[model samples]
Target: MLLAPENTRFSFALLWTLATFSGFLLSLLFIEIGEKPDIGVLEATVGGFAIALLQGCLLKQPIFCIRWILSSLLGWSIITAIGIGALGWIVPSTEFLPLRILYGAIYGGLGGLGIGLTQWLAISQPMAVVWRWIFVSSASWAIAIPFGSVVGIILRRLTHLFLGEVMGLAITWLVVGILTGINAHKLRS
Candidate 1:
């Protein structure tokens, strides 16, 4: 099993796929629970960036702009699919979906740096010792995702505690962190 360290277009493409799929899944999660405006791009932004930066900092990979664009669009596709498909569950709000999508891109683009920063803070070192990055990132994600989601929903006075943003990203970290561990073990082997 050769889990190639992300280095080039191919790796970023894979990252885009994973991020998009995860975003779609997260959006589906909302649809299942009767959400209409539920977005997915935010999740992919955070998750893709999370994994991208992880691979970049740990493996010294390079991710370009195209990857981000594709990832964001893919994530938004899920939102569109659910918003259009699930009519019964979706409540048409005054908030413009198109505007939200645009806002998601803008925010995701800017906030995407959180991913790189998280990776840099936690996974910059290349040592054979047991690292504490996973725990640190996990803790931070927990606080950040839930806090943002809860506060945003509350401020808007919404009912659902949906955190399609950084939550999936934390899950991605769990999986990719395992990948990183495997890569380390393989190196040792």
Candidate 2:
């Protein structure tokens, strides 16, 4: 019997997908139950940080884990602050749904950029691998928000109000996972 070569890329992607999915689901549940937004944020932060640490473990790089944790936390905080600050200005309180979605996509992309840059600086991977990391992370984040918003809109139309965003997030993370896996493999090679 011949065994297939171990693909760390796929493993990393799968783990990331599961972690993000779980975090989004938990946030949705809290939203449905009328919990505070802070709870959701906290849950998501913890989940993301935990998953990042796991990735470090898989890569046998404790420095990457620590950097990821710090970077993720800082990136999220900065983005969230910017989003709130810009909400009334760029995405007025009375803005239409589509506009809001666009804003989210832009914000997500920027935040992802920060995370990607941090990953590149901290991971000590080859230049190409680091570049790929930046590109994939930024693109995934940028695309996910709008895609999720669309899903949410459709679900709302279908009267599945709560699940729409959740479904959108799932789809986004699925794509991210696939991309991450591919890149991980490439990096290994």
* Cα-based lDDT for every prediction: 0.36, 0.54
- Model 2's TM-score against the true structure: 0.68
lDDT of model number 1: 0.36
Candidate 2 residue spans exceeding 4 A from truth: 1-8, 23-44, 84-101, 185-189
TM-score of 1: 0.26
Best candidate, lDDT? 2
Candidate 1 lDDT, tens digit per residue, 26-139?
Answer: 444434322345534454344344333333333322342334334434433343443332211222232344544444333333333333233433332454332343333333
Could you tell me every candidate's TM-score relative to the true structure? 0.26, 0.68
Candidate 1 error regions (>4 Å): 1-130, 158-189
Worst 10 residues of 1 by lDDT: 85-94
Clashing pairs in 2: none
Error of 1 at 93 (Å): 16
